[model samples]
Target chain A: MLDINKVKQRIESLKKLPAIGSKSVKEVLEENGFSRRDFLKWSGALAVSLGLPATFAPVVADAAEVSNRLPVVWLHLAECTGCSESLIRTDAPTIDDLIFNYISLEYHDTIMAAAGWQAEENFEEALKKFKGRYVLCVEGGVPTKDGGDFLTIGPDAETGLSKLKRTAKDAAAIIAVGTCSSFGGIQAAYPNPTGAKGIHKVLNKQVINVPGCPPSAKNIVGTIVYVILFGQLPAVDNFNRPKFAYGMRIHDLCERRGHFDAGEFVEEFGSEEAMNGFCLYKKGCKGPYTFNNCSRERFNQHTSWPVQAGHGCIGCSEPDFWDSMAPYEEPLANHKFESISADATADKVGITILTLAGVAVAAHAAISAIKPPKE
Target chain B: MKITKKIITKIEGEATLKLYKKDSLIEFAEIEFWQYRGMEEYLKNRNYMDACVINPRICGICGHSHLIATSKAIENALNIKITKKAKILREITLGLEIIQNHIKWFYITLYPSVKEINYFKALEFSREIAKIIALIAGQFPHNSYAVPGGVTCDLTNLEIIKVKNFLSKMFDKYQEIIDINGKSEDLEILFEDIPKETGKGINKFLVLGDNLYFKSNGNAEFIKEEDSISLNKNVLYKGSFYEVGPLARNLENYLIKKVYEKYQDSIYTRIFARLYEVNLIFQYLLKRIDEIDINEKNYIKPTKKSGKGVGIVEAPRGSLIHQIEIEDEKIKSYNIIVPTQFNLSNGTKESPSPAQASLIGEYEKQSDLIFKCFDICAVCVSH
Candidate 1:
């Protein structure tokens, strides 16, 4: 169904442009929907669509070899591996291809084949070999409770907290890839037992945090590209994430923002109001409080994100996505409210009114029956 | 020997794996999710819409899955039927997440665990793949695009083109990745001379199955309804206990035999499977883009209805189900069952936990084995 040659030829043409690669050229084409045939038939038109320099297609092959691929060491501590799950699903460059040609991933625990002493050996070897020149990506927060027994790496001399600290010390830069590593996420929420913390607190150094339940692939890749292209970190937010990615609020870009502003909400599910695509705010949409481009970058290769799926933003991008945002039905309340508290919709109003009316009638009848006897 | 193996450090939430071993082998194991947010209990008597907000907070990576599942649950409770557009939109969003999640795990999570593979490049590759998807959604790791009745965003022709282009880019990347294992005869011979780590032969793989055919118009029909996987859905494992997570989802799709037919049941097989998913989803996304008629109705408005509703979807982690009871515009009772519950729950006498049951007679290192069998997210578990 998709013409492969036309795509390849256009990619070849785009490769000729300055600062472009097979990867980037392909990205422009895919994002703009210029099939290979489209490229072959209308390179100029496709170029205009992607806002590309006209000379891109002629010389891309020469520029494709500048691989500033860095070695990355990913550390996990207190986490659910959801960040890991999120990381594996990048549709644009697809992780597998990246691993094959672009970057030199030296060591990690989950996807690697080496285990036990050998796995640990690989980590140590990579540390010594790639020290101060590798990228350190942390997915989970570190537990600082009781000498960090909350997490350990292999029933050995090294604890997870200590290993993260040790590994982070030698890295050129650290990418905190998830909310857990960014701000301790839920493990550190509400009386954190392990004293779980983000990389900034544990490492005693500044790290770029790509925060989210699992940060989008663009933020992660764009930041990496910025670093690769410029040999330095991109401009970042106060939270240490690149400003380019974490700049917008979910509500600002929401398609249903008009409905929210109009105060037209779905009062009940399966109701005509709900079927009509009303606002989910009263239904607990957190687009107002959350920050992310979910409305713009629908998940699954731009297919859709959570909100488009007929749900509301749950604010997974913020710190403490679990504890701070839970009782998911209630609005953001001040402290002192119990965690996981429900909202008022659970008690149907009709039942309460019916119960009250029935009780009143029964009371009156009993009273009348008793009055006759007394008289 | 009484061996106390304590596994901790968390991603979404905190959890500890305490294993009792005999002679350096696991005799028994207990995984305790350390954090309990009590969200389910707190959801009592709350506005049904609250789920959209709270459920996503259950776990960051799968928060989108929670948002969709929770919304479906509320819709079910209210006995509301969302529009075909809305349903397809939900599926697309989830599919995107699945693509992102699978790539993340394959490169960031699974590949890192392998001793022979280089993961820094993997991270780069993974991020690039993520970036393409992010361009459309604008960011990664997490995106909140769903609303109560439909998504808050709409795609333009240019944007649709952008998605198709991104998918094409992903295909090129996938081909390159496939080439790494020596797809080229010359390169294979050159690489073969150099000693490299290969997969230890293991014939164990688990998968969830989705074998329903979509109509030419792109609408899917259900073979049966069982919380998740309404259209000819089935869960299978070698030992009756299949795996769940990115690996399982990829395997399921692979079993459907639409994408990534090259690799199967090896270290590279597993890695390539996840990578292929990114490419495969691109095809699906392209088709979906065409199927979406902007002029078509986005949702179906529902009124107060007295009935129960159940919503189910295949989460990035696995099958997620949410059931609720609503009477007269209010929730009478609410129940949510996440994929982790089915995968991690202690099974009946006849069956062990899907993850645990698969661990029989396999005396690999506890940590490595557990990571392979399951993606344990305490945040999803406790929430």
Candidate 2:
């Protein structure tokens, strides 16, 4: 039987905590013990049921709570606050609250109560206090031309380029939080004007990059926690992202790999194949080249990710997805059969394949028509 | 002074924020959009049908929606009248994309701050949802399903049955979820519970209602139906134009509009509007699927003719307009007005932009209010 009064009592008691208001207390109670203990088991069971990473449960939980929480000094470059909005939405056990309370987030632009010169002062103070100790988290990319004139700092007086470098110098480790911060993002695509560059390029340091239009909140949190626990950053790949997070390509984990192998694809957005969850390769998905934990971390607390929601990977996690991943009608990497040389245009390959398929079908039909009667 | 910020990138391009302080309270806030793709420029000199594949890749989360919208715009420019079969097919795909987008937005963007699950389950849920999405769209983030003329694939009975089954199962789960967590109806009670969104101060509706008298095929509400309001012009609230997006879409709908009108334009309205879309689209998906005609071809292969065309579709975000001017088989001029342009642009002092209206006049603290109002996408706006 479900305990009612006990839950109410727990709510009443938990509400006594300093920050645990009655609203929060009620939420916890409403979820019952599942929010406390069963959430992981439930997720683990579901992951196993869904043939995903089952062991990631405790790993994620334990990563959420580790010792020596690193101080993170977040630097904003040229961009919107969507990345921050996405971040605050991560649902790890009190992770948002924990991020606020437990971890030493010395300076952040979006949610920080301080603004203007006072905000800059706060950043300076934090940098001074946590020099050679804090983790530097960079959102957005650095504009290189005109002395980074594309954006300005707290006041428009000085450029943001100097401000970013000044702060980055004192950091123990650096994390590029978005695709822009990771590999120049859309800003650096095609006709790059501002001459944008990722964090590692501007700083010339081995910064861990978490690339996405806006990366998963859980991925961000897990990475921070991993850093806190292990002291040095987690093992990163060539892109300087934690191997644990960006180790696998999206294709490896894509649910529609079966469809790709079966030669089934969604030719249009509203087709029946799309409703049936077919491969989006033919429709211009970047799953084959993109690398990230989106297939695992997912946006909005695993409710759904991009592909699951009926869109393909635009290779946001890759370098210059906007420029390199363009002409969405074609794939970025190898085309199967190596049939058409990599240099061949999508239209040419498509036409050639169509012709071959037509000829093959015609020959098969003629042979069938001419075949002797079977017993 | 104490300062706090969540450094996040990868959601919708790159976003970093810095807050300034006067004493203990925040005084000024700066939001930076570092990445610019120049999509308008990218579209230049490309085939008009390029949007069918390219627009969807703009933002992984809403790519399919963009693709459909772009395709619709092309259909309009080309004067290609779609049959009911094509309309239903379009609706089904768009509806599914909308459903998944909203659900994922809730799970990934909104739910994290709800003080519900810890970080562990959040990751787990994200993975599961991504897989489920992949089962349908082939990949996550940016799926390119919208093709010019019509959808790329035809629906088989088996595929339709599978989709119907999945949708039914998902809806049942969501119903239980609302019942447990609290339904939008509970939120609707904000008329009495939350005073800010309702009462006399409620804003007027600015929508794309077709009030025309004649029967036009591509019209949203009723082709050429009277009483349909023209939403082409900017929305004037008080003395200025208010932008549209998921929130604006909700205002146009009859049901959630009531709840949101009650909330006026608070964070509740912004959040609820998107969630309600998720719920509404689920129903729309079923209806669209039922109306689909399997026998008729969904697409007509377009010849790469030398001409210009514009495409527009109602993305999950809002009205996405793509204009393409082609010359001698190459794109000459390409212009796109994304939903974010309306939501995030800086407006004049009088009426202010929709995001600006939400911010300039109201709210004691500006950062939170700005985030609520702007609903910004640095990528979409900048690029």
Candidate 3:
């Protein structure tokens, strides 16, 4: 229950923050040949996703109109730049919503025109200019092993871990964008040769984790919008993720739940059963166990998600999903690759094994196929 | 001349260019990639199907390319037989990926670098194309809908209608972009004051992937990765460096023919080749989408699960190869030879990589624009 008065009061003061360069958000969008209507419609959709009433569109519109855009320093570490691609690919690029109108992005490695020493200067200058003001948005995990030489940054070649430390030391808020930065991601899975860890683990500050192999633009934007609107991190789950976006289980809101209840399942990919859009539980759909709004918000401008396209969810939004969520073809709890029977036992999915008979098999059948299950 | 090191940003991942200048002339260049996620290394000990999900993360812009490539690799490893309908559908989606990738590269990367203004509207339309992709495959950038057999999603005639409607709106948006940006086709519009015939790197081509328009040279049929394949960033085909991407597609477009006649294999020929390919693919897709018989099957599972095979695709950047050695459905070793490696391998006076050879004889400062022409993908090469 947020107080409307305090929200209004906070917005009034936050609106006075200094703008980047001479260009207002409106001017930048227009100069870029973008219509304000598209941005407005997008932000309004973001409000709806934020659980604010559809009527609250004007409230957001009012705040965004006057709110001085904060500088966002986006960093890439041991990553695929998928998160950057995910964030910058869309017009608005929300984590589905506000890289455009709400923030002044001073330095993003992928989108910025400059490179080499000039690019490195841009990063350093942004840190100096917006010291303690800009939000440090990291997109990958930090490698802290063997003196962290596995991943280095800039011409000076400082370890990625140190670069992050230097950058995060003076940030207003720190947001780890994707699963790599959120939970050490794929690199952290299986042997973890680079010794990568989530930014929250590496950093001393209270880092907000937005875990998804590549989280939807809406969820990414939704978290940033929460910070912009409330001037603080929204309520977080146990994983330090903003609850506004990660509160519900994908199973509860899944479009194919009825099939799961009816005991109908997709036995194989592209089968008549699959074409019928039966539940993917037997086919290893992680929807029943995973959390996030993929089914509702979708991806690439809310067009579709993995399950909707007839593939099983990989439980990507959860922590260490690369390790835990695999044997991606089978259910999370029970690695019964041999059966689609009625009395199948769930495997070792730790946090939320949606329908797999509830038990934590932290490191279960993920490493097994012809071999026996792990202890 | 002192060696000038330029850190090339604004790629799928970060990269650096080491320019060896002699008397103010760029004599040779070496591009370096710093991070390696060990993409192939991690895929080991995992199930054969997992590579589809993991490989796409290698590069967000070309995730679908990786997905299709990985699916094909696994299918090859397992000797899967897919229907004709699946092949067409894969082509359609892959074409969509190349189209959206070109638009983003043109608008987001190329436009901003050259014009110094952000044309943000068309990016929305590009996402609309990604929506079309998501309609068929579930997600863009990362969705493992393409399995060992065929694809996961089965489309109906009604869904095809939705895709068409979206395409119509996309056409209108592109019209808006061309209207605002004035469809500048000249090389100056892209490189901004850079002279003609500047980035004419080694005038050779390589297209390993089989596409309908581009005739494959039968290079891939006889060679296998296991017998002899470089395990590093640099790759060689029959002991020579070759360029890939649209430039290598060798499209027989009138404009491309004229451009090549004028500038040879310079940046103009290379860049125009991509734009021309996008136009060709877009037209082909419009016709092909209407021809999709919803009655046809989309997938067929493989018979065998233990073997070695390679999957190759002409990604937005260039030729992408996925090599696999699977034992009993579990990956024994996975090797991915991405395109940038071919274009950006170490170069010398006698023999040079495509992009590297392009840099020779150019001035030091012109290296950035010239390098961007290749669309270097750092993560893909490293992965």
Candidate 4:
């Protein structure tokens, strides 16, 4: 038989730790209408999403509650507000509680009550108050064409790039929230009239990229919590994305990897192979090349992800995905030459190479037959 | 006089609104979209099919609609006939996107500006709807599930059961919002107190494509294609400044027609129409799921590649149309006329833009509410 009273006492003591002070995790959970069991389950899921073991759930929860909640100044620039949308709809803590209790979201134009000059004032005040302390979260790409006239945040003459520079000057560190802010998403696609570039290009500073079309909400929160607990950024890859979140290729973690190795592939939509859950590699899946934890940390509260839904990975999180990993329904060629025709497929080039070799061998045989051997 | 210039916030995308006042009364209002990404220019010389993936990034809220429109345009260009199962799945996915968009607009954008409601509940419901989308369409905000020929996903028994369970719960939740004593007349009563002319725009309405509710009549000649640039010359059919979205869909709805008769094109009717459409589409989706036959073919192979085509979808905001010209299997030119371009027009000869027209009155203090009443998506407008 379990000692219920003793268990409650132990939980109470755990809640009183410096990391989890008077406002216990249980209290916050209850306020969000979540039971203690639910909180535990959510924490465990968060731990998994953060690439940590299930046993580390309690530690993660403690770390989340221990540090002083940082003030987040979220700036929206010349891209869609999808990252903010994804962040607000996270299931665990509920966006209401996340903004109200977890972190001080000082300025977000889309959700903040303040508007016009007042909103600008709030941004300035937060910049001054938490100078060199608060995290600067930029969601969209910054346009640098025509002196950055494409995107302006406020009534002032400061362009999006100028504002980002000004804010980063007083920030502890910068977090580029989406692919737009990280690697210049669709806005930076070919013929980029606005000259939209990621934050790393404009501001000569290290900006941790949480790169997805709109990154999974759990990843966003996990990155922020890691910053809060460790008092520094996590280990990043060549792209500046945290290795924990984007360390491995999506194909390595895909459920369809067995089929890929077995050489079974879906040649067409709704085919027998597709129904049998074969590999989508032949169908323009960028999974083998793209690095993201989408397969492990599924979207929409772990319901499903792209490949699971029968589509190929578009390689959205990868840098220059729009230019490099395009023609989303076709396989990516191994080598590309700028001088070659854009429509020259890998099969065509391979056939041409094989034909040239065959002809050369035939010519050598003919020469040997026509003339007497030197010996 | 105290005149507020460039006051904008709480919207999906950014915009600048300048209000000119005379003796405390608003004299005129001007709206400008300061951001432009030039998506059309980017589409030139690219593979035609890539539009399905790239077009969705225009507006995060209505991305799936753009995806569907792009897919449809490609299908039109290639003359590919989609299977019944594919059509139904696409419709269901689009329905989910629109439902989520309307719910977000109501609770997140409109409700905060008007009245305080249980926003958490609304977000929860939207998340549930988004889960259905992610199940079939991969993920929300930028899912390119619907390709040129058909959808990339195929339904299984497990998905069917999951969808059925979700629909039942969604129906119950929706009933709680609109149903009163089993006779759902709550919307009518909720808008009875609102004045008829409040936020009323032009009387003209246009629907570009066929949906569960309305059938496409004919193509509206609103845009003209030039040598290199396509211009929206603001062509008027029977009149100018036509309304789209829920209001246009409800113009034909029998139940909403009763409400529209009372309040012509006011904000109350628009909100009621959206709420009504949400319930109607939810019921429609439940039936649509049952109509799906998993064994049937889902896509038809495309044969033709070089042709000009137009595709239109009823987006959450309004009618979203995509036109593409394919030459030698590459996109020669691409032009898109989103719902925002129509509703948030630069004013026509007959009337002002719906957004600007709504701001014309002594209600300068309520400009934000009036602006949001149009559910303006600046990303779509400037894309």
Using TM-score as the measure, the top candidate is: 3
Off by over 4 Å in 1: A1-70, A79-104, A113-117, A143-160, A186-196, A225-234, A247-375, B1-48, B54-68, B76-383
lDDT of 3 by residue, A133-168 (tens): 787789988987887877866777688899999999
TM-score of candidate 1's chain B against its reference?
0.72
What digit string (tens of lDDT, one per residue) describes model 3 on residues B274-365? 76666666666677767777788887867786999889888888888888999988898987878878787875678887888888998886
**Model 4, CA-based lDDT:** 0.73
- Which portions of model 4 show Cα errors greater than 4 Å? A1-28, A52-56, A66-68, A91-104, A334-375, B1-3, B180-197, B222-239, B348-350
Error of 1 at A106 (Å): 1.6
How far residue A307's Cα lies from its native spot in candidate 2, in Å, is: 9.0
Worst 10 residues of 4 chain B by lDDT: B225-234
Clashes of 1: 127
TM-score of chain A of 3: 0.86
Compared with the true structure, what per-residue lDDT tens digits does model 1 show for residues A1-375? Answer: 223354445445533434312344445444544455543434332232222355533222222223223566777666656565555555333432332123433455555444445656777887887667677888777878778765655536356688888988998788887788898876665446667888788788778888877666545655554443344566765567676666667877888777766767765444456557677665556566566666766564555565654456767666555554544443332222432332221222223223223223422231222122211
- DockQ of candidate 4 compared with the true complex: 0.48
- A82-187: candidate 2 lDDT, tens digit per residue: 3554565453333343343234335665444344446667777878876787878887778888777765554333556787788888888888888878887655
After superposing candidate 2 on the true structure, give the runs of residues whose Cα lies further than 4 Å from its correct spot: A1-64, A71-130, A153-160, A211-226, A234-326, A331-375, B1-37, B46-64, B74-134, B149-205, B209-279, B293-300, B340-379
DockQ of 3: 0.50
lDDT of 4 by residue, A42-108 (tens): 5676667666656567755655554334567888887878877677666344532343334543787
Scored against the true structure, residue B202 in model 3 reaches a CA lDDT of 81
Candidate 3, superposed: residue stretches over 4 Å from native: A29-44, A53-56, A66-69, A89-104, A336-375, B165-188, B221-232
